[model samples]
Target: MNERLNRLANLPLRENLQGLAPYGAPQIDVPIQLNVNENTHPLPAEVHRAIVEEVSAAAVGLNRYPDREFTELRERLAAYLGHGLAAENVWAANGSNEVLQQILQAFGGPGRSVMGFPPTYSMYPLLASGTDTTYIPGVRSADYGLSAHDAAEQVKAAAPNIVLLCSPNNPTGTALGLDVVEAVYEAGRASNTVVIVDEAYAEFAHTGTPSALSLLPGRERLIVSRTMSKAFALAGARIGYLAAAPEISDAIRLVRLPYHLSAVTQATGNAALKHIDTLLANVEAIKVQRDRIVSELTRLGFTPASSDSNFVFFGGVKNTKAIWEGLLEAGVIIRDVGIPGHLRVTAGTEAETTAFLVRLEELLTQGVNNSPS
Candidate 1:
């Protein structure tokens, strides 16, 4: 390990990336794995067949470069979103991470900056650094909530070139009200800030929760990003996209690689969009399990947050590390997101959720120890 570190240090790495660790969650091979916020439900047979058929057709054209514009995929995505968006208003990349990275490359760099509220998605700062943009860390409330007034105040004060808002925020599972998005956008108008709302977990959000996509009508600077990885059960397919003004997609074109999205990826995303209703049925099931996790966690004496996503973020653990390890020992793994008394767990299928809850309850009852053995 020391030799590997020394080798890396000797290489001419980018200054910003020198000391950084790659982003990832534990991929432990446990029977009940809920560490990452994945839609643990399997795909429906019809969707599976559609993807297979689409990929098989796309495979025949592997000899040629894919359509640089990916027009059909964009059209399908726009129709899926259904806020009167057109294909020209959409852009996509390998995944949402790449989509964000492309955004940073286009709009952020040295002398520019991006701001994001902390205890939020961990990638915003990394993306900023990778693009040589300064990252401004904004704060959240004591309970990890951000209000419209406070959010607007912070935006007005910072005036960053780019702003990232994660709705149904990661590691917290709470959605931001559109009021906050509107306020932040209004506040950033003075700075001409490009605001991005990442709705990776939007499909799992509670009923009546409005998406930031609803705010896109008159706001050319606002971008609403979504991912098929979570709701469409397509994590391995790596399709993430955004809806914004046509000019935004045009701007991203300047920074995006030629034919960045492959033929197979376009085919897969198009096929999945065809079966949107079927895939979303699974989202409803996940929501049921999510609510169950929140209810059961509260009853178990843990302070679970009001989750709008498919995961539950809870505190009130006596020994977080101990409980995490205890569950691992019991063949059920969840996320210990480095918060002192807090952890996040993905709401998986019914059996998977039950396995996690049962193991967690047993560990709490045992008063599991965190100290080194």
Candidate 2:
């Protein structure tokens, strides 16, 4: 591996790309896999049939390029979002990552910067780098929390061209109050900044967790991105979209590849949207397990954070590495998010959740060292 890396380093890669690692989570196979925050439930059989039928129809037209506009998908997405959004106010890409990359391409590049709070989504900095945009790591509170005032103040200080906010944030699995989005957007106006709220996990958020989508009515520069990969159980389909002003879609068009979203992708997304209720039923079930994980973890004496998303991020480990390895040995796998004393786990089916909890309890009983590693 070292030799291969050395050979690649000699190639004429872009300066910004030097020595950067690719972004992804560990893909280890395990009995109960909950590392990536995927919806563990299988797609409803009805939705599965609909997707196959839609894809089958789309296959007949493979000879031609997909609708470059993917117009119908946009319309359906808008209807699903339902905040007075129209097709003109929507755009989509393979996943929210690509949607965000396009945002950086349109509004950020060398000499421009994008700011994001640390211990948030790991991808934001990597995306900024990939787009040749300067990545400014903004500070979060000591406990990985961000308040509206502190967030606004950070934006004012950085004055970046783009700001990426992840609600019900990754790794931490907690939702941010809309006041943070509102405050940050106001602060960014002075710089004409493009503010993006990544609500990739929004569907799993606990009740009354307000979305930044509600703040979209007047904020043209603000964008709220969502994905079918999570609650919709379409991770393999890779359909992610955003809601913003009509002009924002037009701006992304300037930088987007021709026919970026394929006909099949559009079809699959539309089919799933048709069964939105059915797919979302799994979200409630997953949330049940998520709450259980939180409650049970606290009872086990691990300090689990309050999570609105379908995952738990917890601390109070004496040996983080030991607990992680012990869980792996027990045939369950979760994420060790590189935080000093905290780890994250996605809520799976009741059985999967039970397996994880039972194994975790056993590991604690067996006295796997908790001394921080």
Candidate 3:
């Protein structure tokens, strides 16, 4: 055998090797992109300038490693979350995905289980697998709402070590009511399991919904993870954080890589925080666009979920693949969820939304005319 092939064939690997398709966001260069749920707006000029200045200042310290503790950034994040927590209760990572993986590393392992609701963020199972933890899923109801009763039952039966809940859940864009989340938390508490509230889209929730952070003070096992990628429009900057009890945060820190966050990343996030008002102003605009998109989709005979995030999920227009292809061909990109007949579209700029709607109409009309009488 060739030397390279002989060396590669002897490498050790895990037994859990039923490979799954890799997860990826669409990279189609479309004029109207509503596929990945990214903030359509860019950082304001003032924020960009502040970030450049801050990173420039930090450049002198390049010879030194970043603050492994991330003390200042954690403090800022704690304050930004409005959770009455101090820096001791917070941790940062390259992104929310890394923060999540750290949590799994700290709390999950072989013989222990992690649980999530299906049709939610697709990354949950992968994270569980990466940590050698068993994953259990509870399916959402037809309306995309978690059945609190069913969820409680599942927790009692599965006795998972970690429970992952995503508010304003991705793809579907439906948020769990505070009451439902509280009920789930109570169940997790009784089971002595950790509950992670993934609030990546919490900023887009309706006015009345309470963030999981607000419920953290009394719940020792509850951990809330937030990302700067969504409402903050810092997807490229890669700053995400988790707020938990100090002990839990310490455990996560144990697994985090030193200098995982670059000085520029921290600087960019700090600048973004200083301009939270500007960032949220764009969120308000997206909320309005989300409402309009949902309404238009419904009027076009799609059963759209009542979305509280910057995206909308709809169904009942069969031939989802055909529609997706037609839209892509027309320079529009949207996500085709694995769930049959369902599609998720993000609320982009008003002009992009308009273009998507126009393309959607054309596809639907063509589909109708081609159908057998």
Candidate 4:
């Protein structure tokens, strides 16, 4: 056997994969896919035209490798982020996932610890482990809000090298208020630790929820990552970006792969950026849909989180799995969060939301009838 293979062959694979599951969204071919929080709108014609034109123009460059720096996209992203810095403060990757991985590589590793609050995005712990960093959790308060005092205590006690936070956090649609984020940043800065805010759903946040980017001017240790996936309707284009101080961005750039983003992806992302107005309009519509779903779910007797993201999370229903299964059987699919009796449903188009509610009503009625009197 090869020496490296022989050295690894004796090790248990499960040990490396502890506390992680295979990562993927569901693949059901349901007509109404409310499972993943993808933007339900298709790309508008103008955006589509621009993407096609840009990609076609770049097609001749297939003979050469893409620009390793992705300079133009960086400039465009910097402008989009609206901080005073230029491309020096921006880094692009295959997706926000890669952006996150680079952040972890730059700041987290063996013997160092990374911290996060749970019932947030599921990826933080996995990313920490992939970078060989110790993963620590500071579970949120029972109300799904971050306890800044507890977080500060944890940071002081653990002294982790990196702290990951998600605003308008995933799976729950709850946001870390700016005050809490600033408190976390201060704690991390005092420890010489890096703080990363994952703002994948920032566009959908309720008005006045300050973006961590708004707080980045004087902070050297803070990084805020954003994606064109959710609100931009470009999940398939795979463009994720980071906004940070120049030094940190440079460190992230060093660890990322050369040509980390393809020429086509850069072209597509730029085109999408040009249509930000239209995209935000779609986000507005989705917000309306989200509110309707929340109110309807409440009236249906399920308790939902006061979500500020593009989805709603509700619980307190009996037979959660049965309701989920029933929805699937009815050709509507929503996410089954592992939290007992809780499930998440993404805001879809008006038609899709109507279908989901209709199916949910059926499930509720059936559940009541099947219950033991």
Candidate 5:
């Protein structure tokens, strides 16, 4: 912890939060950063120019507060989704994290319980704690696959107010089939539990993989959250939104702060929508690198899970921290996701991917951890 932050902890604070550390991955300044799941591609110039012009127009209204409803932004997002969803079913926020926090605020506050499969997103528990919701950890397979049966069984057991399902779950890139979503949603209905399907990496999923948004027609308690931070290459712009039934969107509005979406944010997101095609052009390239990494890593004797997202999670790591350190020292960085023998790395450009595999191979050949016994 930073010395200054440590001293500030001495001040008055909530008891539950007294000893809790903030959540974040290492933000190291590495030459090739494959840690954070950010789109390594540069922004498309067409989209960049559009954003500049639109934001400049928004700047003219700097004196006025942003639209409280952020109506236009919602409509733009709905159009992008194009599953017969309308603005009434969409809600926008600064980031997917905030969108989740708002959901917890509305449906998961004190006395309510929230449940999620383990080793998913690290933020679920933190969001629960921040909102005074009790966090229940559910079980997944050793490889992090959650079966529909187990999902329903756990939901029935916990009887939580909110159930979070992470498709193409973080730390491991496994996506849930629609059967799993249907099972879990059906299971939750008995307790009136709100089921949240987080699809932050959905854009990177293989074609024909269904989104939870498609299952939203009659499921009122289901909310599917997404972000522009990943495949859209707009992490710096900080736009995330969710799609649900109109009533669920209404519930989020009750908890969101007034004028939460700034005019600039609305404008930037709208402009990005105009060029969604160009912005998402790198997704296929990323998928190529992702698949390449999986094949090459398997050939090198490491066990990598089948990935539908932009990153790969591999085990057979004898020492995760050791491997991570070796990569960092070689000017490449990957995530040590706290799984004993596992690490995750985002798919970057072709050159970056080759650089990572070459350096990792060098480390392995040198017998950093793996050795021919």
Candidate 6:
């Protein structure tokens, strides 16, 4: 083993954390990076200016702690959601991962368990483990689809205290229907399970697809988590939030640290919200590229899942590792999501997408295909 690992192994780390790898995607510098599902587009110049101006204003007040409640930020977010939701129904944190962690903190722990459908966000189980909660993973269909019957039946059987459903699931790019959401909720009613719908990729979902936020009227146990990372082109901002019952927000308050969100974060996020339209201007363009990647991959005889999100998950590789190395050699870096014979790639700029496609085609033509023995 390497010296770094050897040194770490000698430390007095907790047994549960011992030998557990940190959650991370490779961050190699490449000409075209489609590994992480980050927005390829940068913020519009106008939004950049607004953020700069707001943060500059906030800088003067750095001597004092920000409003612990983040009142104005929540108000703006509630208005943006527009489901008649007030600030009381919203909660913000470092990211949706933290938001989910706080959820597990408040509602999950020892003796209580949280569950999720697999090949979804890889973070769900990690978040549960971090909160000292037991994690139970449910199975999805061969095609990575989870129907209402499948969800309800599994939820009823497991009876976990918390259930996480990732819409437009990561590494699969398939969306969960509202029918599935309703079924899981109904099944958990007797047990009072908290159902969380992670919608980090919500904004990139295809038109006419409804958000889980629309289903939050009387479902007190339901929480819809969202992020500005994907569609708003603000991954660097590290702001994510959730909309649920006011009581749910109140519960999270018990776990969140005081002044967790800084004045600069509140100001920058508010500024971004004010220029939402401008920030979202590139979403359609990104969608067009995403669709192009899917169609082109299909035409190349690869089976790419129908993608509503800003990325594509394609399969049918006989040797994913070989293709990964080949792509890297060609300066195109994508993700190997630990799924056998499958990989995912975020939709990059038009030129970057073309580069990826061309490089992939060249590799295929050069006999990079390695069938499983």
Stretches of candidate 5 off by over 4 Å are 1-9, 371-373
**Candidate 4 wrong stretches, greater than 4 Å:** 1-14, 18-20, 368-373
Return the TM-score for candidate 5, rounded to 2 decimals. Answer: 0.97
Clash pairs, candidate 4, are: 168-175
Model 6 scores worst on lDDT over the 10 consecutive residues at 364-373
TM-score of each: 0.98, 0.99, 0.94, 0.94, 0.97, 0.97
Candidate 2 local Cα displacement, residue 133, angstroms: 0.4
* Candidate 1: stretches off by over 4 Å: 369-373
Q: Report every candidate's CA lDDT.
A: 0.92, 0.92, 0.84, 0.84, 0.91, 0.91
Cand. 3 TM to true fold: 0.94
Global CA lDDT of candidate 3, please?
0.84
Clash counts for the predictions, in order:
0, 5, 0, 1, 0, 0
Of 1 and 4, the candidate ranking higher by lDDT: 1
* Candidate 1 lDDT over residue span 209-240, tens digit each: 99998899889999999999999999999999
Model 5, C-alpha of 248: deviation from truth (Å): 1.1
Q: Which ten residues in a row have the lowest lDDT in candidate 5?
A: 364-373
Full ranking by TM-score: 2, 1, 6, 5, 3, 4
Please provide, for model 3 over 202-316, each residue's C-alpha lDDT reduced to its tens digit, 9 standing for 90 to 100: 8998888788788888788989899999898888888889888889987876787777888777777777787788777899889989999999998898899988889999988
lDDT tens digits by residue: candidate 2, 160-278: 99999998898898899989999999999899999999999998888888989899988999999999899999999998999999999999999999999989999999899899899
Q: TM-score: which is higher, 2 or 4?
A: 2
**Number of the top candidate by TM-score?**
2
Q: After superposition on all CA atoms, what RMSD does each candidate show versus the true structure?
A: 1.5, 0.9, 3.0, 3.6, 1.7, 1.3
Query: How well does model 4 score by local distance difference test?
Result: 0.84
When 3 and 6 are scored with TM-score, the better candidate is 6
* Tens digit per residue, CA lDDT, model 6, 57-154: 99999999999999999999999889899999999999888999999999998889999989889888788778878899999888889999999999
lDDT of 4 by residue, 1-373 (tens): 4676666666676464654555777889978899889998998888899999999988889888888888888888888878586999998888899999888888887878889888878887788778888899887888777877877778878788898888888888988877777888788766798988999999998878788898888889989999999999998898899898889877876687777788889888877777788766799899999999999999988899988899999977677767778889889999986777788999999999999998888877766424422
